[model samples]
Target: MLSPSPNSIKKAFSRVALVGKYQADGMQEHLGDLAKLLGQQGCEIFIEASTAAHLSLTAYPTKKIETFAGAIDLAVVLGGDGTMLGIGRQLAGSQVPLVGINMGRLGYMTDIPIQSVQTILPQIIAGEYEADTRTLLAAVVLRNGEEINRSLALNDVVVNRSGISGMVGLAVKVNGSFMYNLRSDGLIISTPTGSTAYALSAGGPILHPRVAGILLAPIAPHSLSNRPIVLPQDIMVSIEVVDGREIIVNFDMQSQTHLQTGDTIQVRQSEKTITLLHPRAHSDYKTLREKLHWNEYPSTF
Candidate 1:
């Protein structure tokens, strides 16, 4: 479980922003009700522009995410973890706390269910909550020794085969030291916050969100000896695609870019961090047990 820092307690979230999936079922109603609740508590509310358009909500002021940096105090995401991942990358360095309302399957990050929003939201607005900070990965794609693209990920950065069905060769390096060359279908570089995401599906270990480490998990590795490895948070990782293979690099599964044979992708811990606000009752172990259906039955002695 992540403990809240002293500074994060009793934060005055007077201005709040709402971001939700476009046209999701019952999204309009949930967002409307949430806005009303916050408003009744004397908190100013802002709706993300696209969400406002989809819900035809003109009651609250609509603003784009880029404009939320200095103006908004808190961001309330009303979708699943995917929505939070996208928005989390944007708000990583902004120091604006986020609260997630689950509207999608397997809401690891979006823990707050829609049914409990009414009950929990009041406590959160009154500063009865715990805030946990999670790390993010910064990736830079280089072609011919020149940087081409850069992106941030709150979950993971995936380097996988572009179109071919065959395996791709990737040379892994950490802090300029060689690790190993992996020939696999793909590779996943994940943060602790992303341990339960693609990494878990690829046989990576589940890491606590507060753990300061990065995970490198091979996807369908050709050899049994190649296994997932966890590295210290401060090291830099470089993965270069071997010749004659085309690969695609994905950031948080939200954005993608094609990579050439000689292209290199450098991933390191980002200087920014995402702050997640959880209710006082939040427990990572309980969440994991519930989400993964673990230890569901009582053991008989």
Candidate 2:
């Protein structure tokens, strides 16, 4: 979590960034409306140059993803989690607070509704929201002792077979300690913030955001006895491509590259974190029960 400094309130914003799914379903017209609304309130809207070109809007001038970090106070992402993820990569090291507006279904991260942006924009500009700092995982893929790809993830780092019918073997280690060898579709190394995502589908536990740990779960493990394991946040988890003629490494929704045998990936807690702005009263448990349709085993009634 981000600690409020004495100057925190003074750091309240007048300039904001507008981000949305490029070519999102039914959002193009609304984007222009949102920009007009925010502009009416004296907020400067900074957008990606590509998005600007895509929309062909003249009033809402834009900046490149690289320059957006230094130019805005906060980023309002109008779409689902994937849109937020794309923006997160651009703002990763900068520690910019991202407010997600849900324009899609099953939005675990993007919580705000389109109709509420105008109502909530003022409060957010006034620093009336709480910030949840979600830790990220950094991964480096190496082949033949050469670094092939490096990326950071707000969700999970996955290694699996690429369209192959056969299961892949992944060797795992935590803090230099041997964990297990697994024959599965893939492996997921996720933070507590991502437990509700693909990890949950693999039988991993849903973790509270404040929890300082990581979840390692196997995707469709051949051995039914294999289960998700939680580990201390400080430990480094390593996965090696043990076998398979073809494999792939993925960070969140983006796939990095195809991997040959003898490739290894090192995953650890990233030094930088993503700051997510939430309504003051947002509750993780409530979100889960509602969004995930997770019924309480026995109702209190």
The C-alpha TM-scores of every prediction are 0.93, 0.91
Off by over 4 Å in 2: 1-11, 295-300
**Best model per lDDT:** 1
Listed per model in order, the count of residue pairs whose N, CA or C atoms clash below 3 Å is 0, 0
Q: Give the TM-score of candidate 1.
A: 0.93
Report the C-alpha lDDT of model 1 over 270-294, residue by residue, as the tens digit. Answer: 9999899999978999889888988
Give the clashing pairs for model 2: none
User: lDDT tens string, model 2, 1-301?
Assistant: 9855433433366677777787886667878877776666567777767777776766767877777666777888888888887777668878568898986464778888777778876677777788888888999998899998899998889887767558998889887898899999999899887898889998999989889998998999999988998999999998888897677888996757788777889999999887899777877777788787777566874
TM-score between model 2 and native:
0.91
What residue runs in model 1 are displaced by over 4 Å at the alpha carbon? 1-11, 104-106, 299-301
Q: All candidates' lDDT scores?
A: 0.89, 0.81
Clashes of 2: 0
